[model samples]
Target: MSVIVGVATLTVVATGFSPHTAERETVHWSYQGSTGPEHWAGLSEDFAACGAGREQSPIDLPEDTAVGTSSDEAITIDYHPVTAKLVNNGHTVQANVSPGSRIIIDGTPYELQQFHFHLPSEHTEDGEHTAMEMHFVHADEAGDLAVVGVLMEKERGDSAFTDLWDRLPTEEGDEAQINEPFDLAEFLPNDRDQYQYDGSLTTPPCTEGLKWIVLDDPVSVTPSQVAAYREVFHRSNRPTQPLNDRVLTLVED
Candidate 1:
């Protein structure tokens, strides 16, 4: 599968679609039962990556890690205000941002594509779970994938996600326009420290060779936001896959 990423365009993660998949790719799978993540590889021959990939994702950040920094891995986000669109892909609620937002990693510019959520977090801290996690999927012109993850914990007051929750498409393959002004920069935590690893996509077709950087710092979301998300997807997060000798680096603050 030859992946083709854009310079800075809106790209949402459709159900059963991977960064490595074609633009018109339509895959059939689910989050549970007969055609679930556990049984994804058997669904089709093209899904071989789901079961046999050595560098799978959503691994627990191992305990007792050393802190370090690398100029080569530094992230510089140049996100701009863009119109948002919401899509209920049956698995989770995905938000697509308009063009203009982009992130430069070590001088390589990666376009800010789309973002989606996973309940109870995916990657954990020594087996600890958070309220939720958001994946900001980005890619370069070559279709190389790089995801920046920000964990969301349960808190009080309101959340930036309220606008999205209000317009979620309950049914599968439903999409709606978001009239609100969406700022991608607002999702960043004050602490830029992160845990970097080489892993595959958490969803089926689980394509490998993607660059993943999960921020150690998490943002806060109101309890109402958590409840609202649960109503839509109670358990969208994939189970933690084995680190399997893969090294996780702690990027110091």
Candidate 2:
């Protein structure tokens, strides 16, 4: 079962925020070419679970499932935009976040630890694809998982994006933080309609038991932003998997 929540927005834009010192930590990644998603778990010992997990994300949604109750959850999210730095992971270019944001879903609140982007979209509908998508990863006090996805399309006059994209970090392991607060509501579509389902993570350690919500409407970005993103991540979306008889609900007004 699932529930959808909605909110209003202020004239929010993404731009030069602030830059932070790169916290040195030992971590593994599944990037493109040599270390892509297909070989994430194999790349490092920390990601063994990613390869052997039952539920994974980016599965193709089949048009059939046993109907059940629609979700009625109300979510409250707290996100601050800092300087967002882009890195060309082997799989794609990603904008990594500082660890202080959070999201509340269905009366349950989760912290927004980090976020990333995907090109051509990892998730699809009826075999159709969106131009780009963003994933805000959150976790609750108990470590449960929920994701907030914002989809993007080609348009014009996105100055916030222009500022951010213009100064993206060209190489991996490089980061900059923006000190300004980025209201997540700005990225949301005016319409609150969404789709809810059960799924897993698209990356390695493909853990299951995730609450997946994808907004039906997509926000606009300038062609230059899209072009810049392509230059970094020509393609990083995971191939959609079989739905395995799962249910998907379209939240309607």
Candidate 3:
């Protein structure tokens, strides 16, 4: 498989806001101090959803609060081996995936756009944070977003990320070419049980109405592997947002 890296034509436009305009207006948000997540909405008018949106992302998943569903509702991921491009996009290290890979949820196919990482995880389980978190971002035909969140714990290293870790970019704006075929499906945990909810983007602009599928089981990674990624980014994560009136459904498989 061949993956291409370029700006996507379709933008994730919110009802009355454009994230592109926010990106252009406020270009200096960070993960700490006055410019952090707390100040995102105040930074720009386009980012009003950051503080105002009721259905925000990275919420804590309390097992007791989630309603269980049958295995028939499980999401179908169609990821395969593909040559991809890796880049350090200042905020996090992201892999721009090739076309064709997608995940079918309730019969709607969301094409894979990219995958990125966050240190010390973002979403917590019963208020417990994992070692790391991986986000596989996708988009439907209408440009609506769906994100698959995988939690990572420190233990034995998983070889599925060997090639990616070996070529980790050390600086902001730096990029590395992944000529080897990387199997994204192999990187995921074998169990596909996930907590499904409707939420907004965790980052700046905080666009809402996104489908969030956070896996229940966590994959293992070595402490050294976690350290390797941390060297590039000390910490890149947004705090958990309020769940509000949203219902979290556990789709068992």
Candidate 4:
């Protein structure tokens, strides 16, 4: 797929006492062609996993799986309302939070670093795809990465981000501050049934040894919300990767 990045915007619009960032943006990569996913591995040595890694991400989750109920396999998010820096990197709308937000599994704590989105989602469920996906990336003190994927589809009511939509960074390289406090839980679906697997970063420099947790229940988001993203990222998601020999463990709640 061919894509064209949008021009940056400088206007900071506000409504109902909430503050949002101005629109500024740039195109980061592509889905096809010389700069597309197919050519990512050759783009740099750091991205070799894009083509050669035995464990890649965005696998088609199998409906049947070994259920895991152990405490070590459970995920607990410890997040608080905080001001977030919303940036439009051309690839996706990324929200960067300050220290304090984290997720604890078993006894290890992984600090929430940042989160980004993918249009129409990159992962599939039984050969099916969600309207979009939100990846909440966290890392331990040792720098090991764990990502939480929340799939989204259209539904009733406005988004938790409805108040911040107009303030989203729309132009490439645009960095905007959301004056309103945002809660991570406000965006997650309540259903916690999920799948877990070891995989690489979905994007280049496709580093391996990362933990992927995908919630089975998708959160509700409208097409208009997705359409806003489509305007910035013509096509932002990487293609679903090969499953290779990896075992996907179902996280039973």
Candidate 5:
């Protein structure tokens, strides 16, 4: 599979929150204070959806309210071992993956572009937050976005993230290259059940029409691993948005 690295000039659209190197310099939104999520829309005319969009992301998944569905409706993830570039993009620590990884939703394939971590899981279950959240961002040929969210809980030890946590870039604009291939599937839980919904990007621009597939089971990561990430990005999470009239589907496998 072909992979695109950091070129001096390149345009990346629709892959949610994975801003190109050039665009990163122009956008200056953070997770707190004056230039935080609350002030994202007002910060720039391009980020209008941050405040105005109704179908925003990171919503609470109240099981009782969700529409039940069988395992047949679950999205098919075809992730494999691949080289990845870990980048500290000011907001969150993101892993820009090589091609070959993808997920099939209703027969349409969306290639996995990257995955990022958010401190204190964004989408909550029963209004409860987890230690962290990981978003696997993918995009179809038409530039439509779909995100797979995995909630992380505090456990004793988890080697799945050892390579990433050990090589985390401490400074903004810094990056670490993992030449050796690593399977992203290791990060997921054994169960494939998920909570499905229609939502938008959790960051600036906050574009809507994204298919959100949040796994129901939380993955295990050590407290120290979470701490290691927090040291780089003290906190990077958008509060849960209102669900509005949208229905949350519980896809059980």
Candidate 6:
């Protein structure tokens, strides 16, 4: 049997049929069961690449990899909460972002589009599971993607996420305000040390060329927050893919 890979950009078109604009790309994707990661390539012509990508994402980091900070290329993100709309596209829980939000990575500005939740966390530490994970997806001026991951663990009491948890849309396609602005800057850790590498998207049609930065510090979130995410995606994470000789860089804050 020969391994086949298909892929397509998530570009959206404003007219006719595509929701994405000429500059924007939208992807058709799915997760779990027969249609899970294993079937992504066969399911769609655009997703064939998912099955044959050289650099995939969500790798389990070895516990004793001398994790620390060094370089100063640290990026700063300044995000404000807005009336985000929740859209369950049969993959993971995703949000349709409002306007007026942007993320700065090492001074390079990227516009915030939408974000989504992943459970049991996607990236792992020494194969250990973090309670939850939130992916704040951003795109640069050229439409390139740079995803900033904030890992979540059990906390003693309420944290900033409680506000988000309370406001998370229950049904797919439901939209709501957080009762306040959602700032992306506040959600980031003080130490900007991260593991940077070239990787593909975790979801179907799992496109490559994304600049992946997995933060070292795991943020705190109430158990309720974890449970809230579980309600939507219980162990919805795709299994950790192979490294394939990719160089994982540990940068300074």
lDDT of each: 0.75, 0.59, 0.79, 0.72, 0.82, 0.66
Q: What does candidate 2 score on TM?
A: 0.72
lDDT string for model 4 (60-169, tens) is: 88676544665457688788876788876546678877778998866899988777788778888887888888898887877778889998886768777576677778
Rank order by TM-score, top first? 5, 3, 1, 4, 6, 2
Residue 110 in model 2: lDDT: 78
Cα lDDT of model 1 by residue, 18-129, tens digit: 5455454354565566666687688668678888888998888864863466745667767887887888766777877888888787678888778888888988998898
Query: Could you tell me every candidate's TM-score relative to the true structure?
Result: 0.87, 0.72, 0.90, 0.86, 0.91, 0.81
Per-residue CA lDDT of model 6 for 182-217, tens digit only, reads: 676666677766777778777755677877777888
In model 3, pairs of residues that clash are 3-98
lDDT of 2 at 191: 76
Off by over 4 Å in 5: 1-15, 18-25
Clashing pairs in 1: none
- Model 1: weakest 10-residue lDDT segment is 1-10
lDDT of 5 by residue, 1-253 (tens): 0111121111223225543332533556667777777887897787889899999988999999999998899999999998988886666778888999999999999999899898889999999999999999998988788899999998895457877788887876689999999989999999989999999988777878899999999999898998887777677788999999998999997
Total clashing residue pairs per candidate?
0, 27, 1, 7, 0, 24
Task: Supply the global lDDT for candidate 4.
Answer: 0.72
Model 4 clash tally, residue pairs: 7
User: Native-vs-model 6 lDDT?
Assistant: 0.66
Q: Is candidate 2 or candidate 5 better by TM-score?
A: 5
Per-residue lDDT of model 2, residues 146-211, tens digit only: 887777777777544655665566554455555565655566677756677787777644557888
Go through the candidates in order and give the C-alpha RMSD of each one to the true structure: 6.2, 9.7, 5.8, 6.9, 5.5, 6.2
Which of 1 and 5 is the better model by lDDT? Answer: 5
Which one is best on TM-score?
Answer: 5
